[model samples]
Target: MTIMPNNPPIFSTRKIDLFVPEREELASVLQNGLRYHFVEATVEWVDCPDLTQEPFNLATSGLCGDAVISEISGMSYLFPFMESEFQYSIKRIIKEIYNNFNNGLIIGASICLRLQQQYLVQLGELIMNASFSRITEDDIEIINKSHLAFLDETTGRCALESITNSDPHCYPHGNFFISEGKPGQVLKVRAKKRIGLQFLTALQYSLEKKYSSGIYPKLIGLGGTFVMKSGRARHHIMPYNWDNNLTNARSIHNWLHYCDLDAPLVAVGTLLSSNLVYKDACKFSDLEVCGLTETHFHTFSSNGAAGGHFYTDLESMDPVEYLGYFYPARIFNHVDPRPSCNELIDFTDVMRLATI
Candidate 1:
């Protein structure tokens, strides 16, 4: 593998068009106004004038989720959600994508059972080593309490105040339309490597590990696309957090410069709509980004209905026996059926049989 840089790569000019047939008005507001605040990036938001010109084909298609990935410079980025109901129409598109990937089409996507924009962004940040900063226990608690409200309070005018009070060069903005969950959504952490938990815990863990190892991890203040990357992670976990709020970690870096190392230690956050965009971005740049995925090949929930079956069926043995089940569930799990004898593997049996 190539030694990719661990910093956020700079983006060159790329043409992006907004496709919002479902929420055209919202799309217009976001495309015309919101894009300007996020980056020094050039973009265009066009009204779907074809809606009136074309017949509306209302079909009850079974759609998992959808993602559009772009590849450049050997890295991939998941495209941002186009703010449309294309979710219902992406299955056919994904098949084309799958075929394209096989045929060397640099950009492609997969139709997950329940993929979302937030998940895409989280995955993208990991793929791209964007800037990030650590959060404190207090910060974590506050974020857990009222994240969306925190987002609302900090976006635009609130962000301006935050940047002024913290750093002159830093200004954050909130894209309200990209909001993920309802305010009442309960935010809690299970065994899964949640983005909220990762952003909160990874930095914490890095600090703890650093200190214990007699090395202080440096604190880096990530804003703009950087912090937005963390937000991507936040949305990826789909934690039942009440609100989405952009927090500042630059303060921590400025205040505590000694408790760190030469390697930049930062906590980053961003509000992204999908990993597909991030994946595509990776293709155009070279960066080392890390996000969370299952380590255990056949990991399953330890508390869900499937979890019970996982242990019982294996007679309390290894996890990879029915690993494909885990992947599908990770995408989205409404129903899970055990594999047939034909699907079971001999190597799987050996692990369990040896343990027995």
Candidate 2:
């Protein structure tokens, strides 16, 4: 593998005339004020830097329920595992992730199905009855009380068993899980209802208060994008709503960082979005980019799967020209249903062919 250079080119953008047809008013409002960049370069993975190294521990945090479902889908495609077998596999993966992270805390959040029916009442009940306190080995009663009925009996048992064996202290709020571990020093698993950064901030504050020390927590959002700005700014890029916010050089810097990782940990769902854009004249001069194709781009944009608007800021480094972005085609295992356009391929094949 060729080592990426320390200094890479900056990504640049240009104006494009693409807009969501249904939300034309909204798109017009966005297009009128913003300069859109139509990314023309093929996004390849070789040109980016590798971030899966020391001092940069990556962890996946998002909706565990969705994760569980995705796992089931993936497994079902590859193996002939029955319900019971699948449950066992799920438990094994959960345990494997917990152990892989060195017995660190794992946190998650979700709204209760029962509570969803009675929004006001449930909200009040949750506020009054919920306890956000840290759980320890002795806090069995509290853990059981706070547990929500989101998971099946088998899955819940598996998750609880994994936590109990690894960390001993845990707090389950609705669909969220917060296990006990050292602040920033140890690997931590955190999940919430789309407010992961906010939760992390709160957890940091709590840790500081409890331990009275500095903590540098390494976090990665699963099924989502976590971008670190040029300075100290941090933002979460969701799958939709790209045009709702202003994305400048700092934002692009963070996005490129995700693709630059050694393994390109950015989720496949995010890459499919139209929000990620570049200009026709922009040059990916420095970084090696990966993923997607002209056909995939057309499908994503025409099918309304992609949202958001892109704009150019001369002050920020142009990613296409400097850092470059990677948007590899989605990969599927042997069992995954093939896309009509044949866009999906195995990463191993990509690596072998691309010589990464």
Candidate 3:
């Protein structure tokens, strides 16, 4: 008498639905000027691994935390901010979970500091050195007599006085409606819209046609957050920062190989900007994990490896032993610096063959 077969469900019950944008629909999309605002989230599938091991933190558990988890490549990410918000709402909830998490396996995510081109060329050289050292030559002759061409009609006041005197690579790149102060207290300065890679490849082709037919419940993991400027005064601007290039780490390894999602992508930033963009996008792709925060390994003294894991406080972790020690698939090809007790017995034999 022999009959053996009945497993596949170590614990699986996942659902995280979040779509925020109300406050009069974000003040009518910023009074119709529309810089960019849209947040949508939907997840359903429940068995229960402590809801992906106690995730939701959206910075001090606000936007209804406990579903927004993180791990990265060794795979273990739920989604949503660790912290920071207010009309920038955790950078639009990390760009709507990196443009709608494509169905299954997404190891190591986090690439969108507005699609980092050296953090938008150091935020356009700090807004052209704060508009040429806090502008004034009567604020470029009241912006070239408000004729508004922004300059260069026979060297428009010598190209607005040579961009406050030389070397922003000798100015001239069109659009420059600049301004400063001392005339009824003017201010103006624009230059913050730079999310093109053809708008993240048409937002991953409309989130792969709204999750084609997996309906949504397999984006394994993802993370990212950065917003620096910090010269300091009363905290002059800083938010989970990090920077590194090589064309923004090969455009996050070519947008995770153009979303062929199979899972892992983490870069929560800060704590040395998520270990320098996860060590420069693992020197061009092959990143299975790098979700950090043991104060980013004690502020970078270093010691969290096995692809890198340290979620010290994603609101008190332990979602079924951090997903039974990062489920398995051989710990997404573990790099080994740590994590070995036979990889916790191959992550409890891949959560007992995922509770078949």
Candidate 4:
């Protein structure tokens, strides 16, 4: 509940050793650099002062279709943005990531899903605070086209440039990893491919009794993660953009201003840096901090920062039902016939269940 501050040495890293004995000589893979330090044992909520402040908004993009930025597996970038992107697509990314080692350098960073979902978080906040009634259908239409898909001509690099230009100090690119996680070093990232339509179920149910379909944004991704760098730190906090040259939201960029009463919706340097491992870490999830499962739960209770964020609100619903699907044990074992996040909640039933 307390406001966390931002300090120098912006992003930190952790020196970890991963031992996945899936193959004979491939027994060890190390250096998961990011390590997070939680304010409280139960990280119920979080705020990024540095990210929301001036010159720190550079990292608020998801790079929607660039799989090569960090040498991300084709599965990671493909499934999430492939229109009909699979939910557990990150698994494909991780599986390939396991083989990409050979004295190679992974410029790790977190890339959130496309832009439409970002708009949902923003619009959801507005409606969550009863601010939707103030906007007209035209505004709704504007938000609809914000997904920033990288079609033929649109360039994802432009978005990356915007972030790099904004955050010059302590940028986590160089291997000068930060040590412990705090507000800035810790971020919320989603592992599942998302359309973010389900979120509207709750938002509409909670309010919008008299609103129309205009309140709804086009379907897109909604997942993000929390990266804690030690060595594992800044790898996952890179600026992600759903925007490309043509689909740019230059007209309506979503900046996270600290002075605004609304929650911080974007970050760059302030995001927690994290890395993945083939050992004891939670398999396939982007938010894993330490490779040890015991410490992972001890650190992060959930992805994102606070209880008010869109993903947080979604996970908080029906704890028993939600947690049963999201717990660590099940996450590691993908062969258990588990489905993706899209199937978790029935959007229609949820919206229909909304009580005016």
Can you write out model 4's per-residue Cα lDDT over 129-178, one digit (the tens) per residue? Answer: 00001123222110110111111123322121111111111110111111
The sequence of per-residue lDDT tens digits that candidate 1 reaches over residues 43-78 is: 222221211111111011110112112212210111
Model 1 RMSD, rounded to 1 decimal: 24.3
Please give the clash total of every predicted structure, in order.
51, 32, 35, 62
Each model's lDDT comes to 0.17, 0.19, 0.18, 0.18
Q: How do the predictions measure up, each by TM-score?
A: 0.17, 0.19, 0.16, 0.19
Task: Give the Å shift of residue 299 in candidate 4.
Answer: 26
User: What value of lDDT does candidate 4 attain over all alpha carbons?
Assistant: 0.18
Give the alpha carbon lDDT tens digit for every residue of 90-164 in model 3. 111222332232111111212111223453311110111111221322221111100010112232211111112
- Please give the lDDT score at residue 118 for candidate 3: 50
Full candidate order by TM-score, most accurate first: 2, 4, 1, 3
Writing each residue's lDDT as its tens digit, candidate 2 over 95-210 gives 33222222322222211212233542110001001112223422222212122212122332101111112212211111112222222111112221221112223222332222
Name the regions of candidate 3 deviating beyond 4 angstroms. Answer: 1-103, 107-111, 115-326, 331-356
**Candidate 4 TM-score versus the reference:** 0.19
List ranges where model 1 is wrong by over 4 Å: 1-90, 100-237, 247-299, 302-356
